[model samples]
Target: MHPCLEQADILELIFKEIYYRPTGSHTEKDLLALALTCQRFKEPALDTLWDTQLTFGPLIKTLGISDAEKESENDAFDRDVRVILTNDSYEPSPEALRRFSSYARRIRRISHVPDARSSILEEMNTELAVLVKLSSWVRSETPGPMFPNLQHLGFIGTLSWTSIPCLIILLESKITTFSMYWGNLDPKESEVLIGLLGRLGLSIEFLELTPLSYIRTPIDPNKPSIFSEMPFPITLSWIIPLLKELRSLSCGSISLNQLALQNLASRCTFYKLQSANTSDDLLEAISDPTADILSPFATLQHLELFEDNFRDFIKLVDYMQPLALQTLILHHTAPPTASTLADLLHSFSEGQHIASLRQFSIKHTVSEFETINSVNMDIVFDGLTLSPLLSFPNLLIVEIDTPCGFDLRDADIRAMAKAWPQLRRLQLGSKIGWGLPPSVTLVGISELLIHCPRLEDFVVPFGARTDPPPITNSTPIKKNMTYLYVGNGRAPGDGSEQMALARFLKHVFPDLCGVGGEWMYEYGLEEEQLDWAAVISLIKTQC
Candidate 1:
């Protein structure tokens, strides 16, 4: 044996490196070979290999309850699949059960994906049932939980009757993180899930539930699914008090209303919510006039809402004065009007979030069948649309992606740079329309570098047709900026213009990494893209 392998810590690290290779045969093959090589290498090697289990095939193979073989050659679709067939009468010996227990206790995470495409799906469910049945026998003779060290359990695929029992048996009070993305469930199945949550008690800290998917008229048109009516929200409300230790939650919008009723929302640290409900329902859920508390999310540190309207977003910001919030993100389909945007900012100025807020982003996506260019030109974002955000002087990151043109001038850019002197990232106007050329020029960007020397990722629209302002001795060289994007920027695309622009960027941003637009050639920037690409090559040679 090698000297390095004699040390337990060094041997574990070596096995871990082999076990975690992203894409290679050495991941499992090398670990398995080492586990069977000798006694010294066996324990560490097996522990490293069985640390995380994604499927039930390995446990079934170890228990000798099933045999896996390739499908028949006649079946073209499943020709490469190895199908498992269980032996109902088979039972492992005492020595084999002890070995299985040893391997099972080593697992820390079990992420079950029950949507395998081949016959293995049912076979794996059968194998899981067999394992659950054997778990009692093992526990009766040898005491303690089947998976004593399991902490994280995830259901990435659909859940059915056969798989639900497997999850129930694995739901230990010691588990801390649970995430599931199951499809629609019947009333009985939903109750079983609720019972499982009750069993989980206060140990879980991170819980994420993806919205269930359903067909319009799968069985009956008039009859609604059990999950669509009110079982989900009711179940969540019943389980809220049991989750006193939960710190993070991500679920549908209806659950927010339910959470508002419970006392748990006040203690949550992070929330990422989305909704397919109407704007009225969203608004009502976020801000209930009848509620007693003024701020439901006072202790939240991060909040991210998606697929809601601008009105609902405004209401949420106003209602949850988030005293300690550090991050706020909103993504909606409807465009925000100038007055609505002003009201939203006014809420921020009056709220207690001004002191602790560091990152604020709002992204809008155009409705289907309508692109940014096709939208009406009456809706545009100007300097006033963003000036109100200057109230939060501690901001470090700000990103706004609107589906309209920006009428900002040189003065607006300078004002923004001066307001957030500690800003590290500033991205605006991602979907630049084709109405008018940007009035800001290269000189305005120089003002940003002058104020915020630590700015790293800068994306904005500016005119590149003219020469930059003269550099003075007081000018500073900003080496932190890596990527500078000029989306939908107006450029002359001439040799003089390219040379002058390259010299100006090199002097101000000496360590500039890349020069290009955010949406390269997506809209009609083919000519402008070529000009910027040339400037990138010139900057590289000069550096």
Candidate 2:
């Protein structure tokens, strides 16, 4: 009797520990083993065992079935579990179907009874009967809400068109997020599902659709059609009105026709539209007036445009100005003419457009340095003044990278530092034909310390073959410097120039906390071997 009492106490401790463990740590099999251990362990272990999110396909295949024996077995399994069959490749054995149906029915019973709070069934690719069975169980057996805490649902592969209307009816009021991939739903069927969500006044915050390869081809361009006239299996137009409550949206690569873009933009506030290996037809769609219906992205704070072919920045500038945006990023190489730069800057600077601009980034792609070498660096420096007009008096970050041709001059550096007195972070990169003059290098660093007294980060990449000149300033180094990055190539005079740079940094910028080493290849040193830590430490100690 004393030994029995001790065993009961040990069992109680194990039960308490299991109850406090986080939900995702254990699998159903593990919990089942614990349940079989003793009567004391059975009840608590069963509780954790049944509260599960189960996926059925991989589990079924893992048990094994021959290809030739699958069809009858699958049919038998479908009847018992109510799984609707869609794809031709899958065929489960009768015994395997029986096992699946038993387990699914058990899960349903456990979820619907008085105690369970949350459950999930994901990636269902089964037949219609199985879905109907599950939905009917939820509707009839569950007491208050079918799935009171059900928050996520995912579908992969196709479902029979007939099964969708029933599935939509069951899911309309419960799920908050739904995702489907590689599935085909005919327009009429899709409309029915949309109508169900509309009738329920459901609020779905996220929606994603990934089209199968066969479904991605555009309808014959030679024919005239409305979106409804297209022969494709899916039309998002029917669901657009219900999508107004969404805060985030991601759609797989699809050709955007004017009607589709207009409908989507009108519904969603934050949007990302991406197309890879684009065609001429899509480009034409963007240039058309209908595209503007989505324009200025009035409530959009972040925007990314890819695979674009507009000749100039004028269109984007005109379209985006009214949004009063905060962040802008432009990719792909565009010819940077002085007029083009001035005009682009003027658009953002004038009026109330982008008055809240805090971060701006422009990335150019060009192999030969000569293409970018043609632009006058002075004009580029002057163009930066355009920011103050937008009330960005304290521009915090700027990144400028262009291929080759322009060199930094002393006057260019002075004008930029003077123009944005409160600038705190700056990154500049120049390709082949561009190198900063020694005077420009010294004055630029000097002017940065003077005008932007609060500056904490600096990255300057010099692609020239000349040595940087010494700083002529008599003022002491400021203690505010915290991070620095410098990438320099081999200069003509070699070690002497490197030594000069080391001394200037050590004496002039004594408080430097971090440094990115110069990469000078000719000194028998690998690019990565440059002693950045040593330099920064030395500067901090000296200051």
**Candidate number of the best TM-score:** 1
What's the lDDT for candidate 2?
Answer: 0.46
| Candidate 2 similarity to native, TM-score | 0.46
Measure candidate 1: CA RMSD. Answer: 8.9
Return the TM-score for each candidate structure.
0.66, 0.46
Which prediction has the highest lDDT against the true structure?
1
lDDT per residue, candidate 2, 98-176, as tens digits? 4443333323211111111112223333433344444443444433343344455555544445555445643644555
- Report every candidate's CA lDDT: 0.64, 0.46
Report the backbone clash tally of model 2: 10
Deviating ranges (above 4 Å) for candidate 2: 1-242, 248-257, 267-296, 307-312, 319-321, 365-394, 410-425, 430-439, 449-457, 462-484, 487-500, 503-543
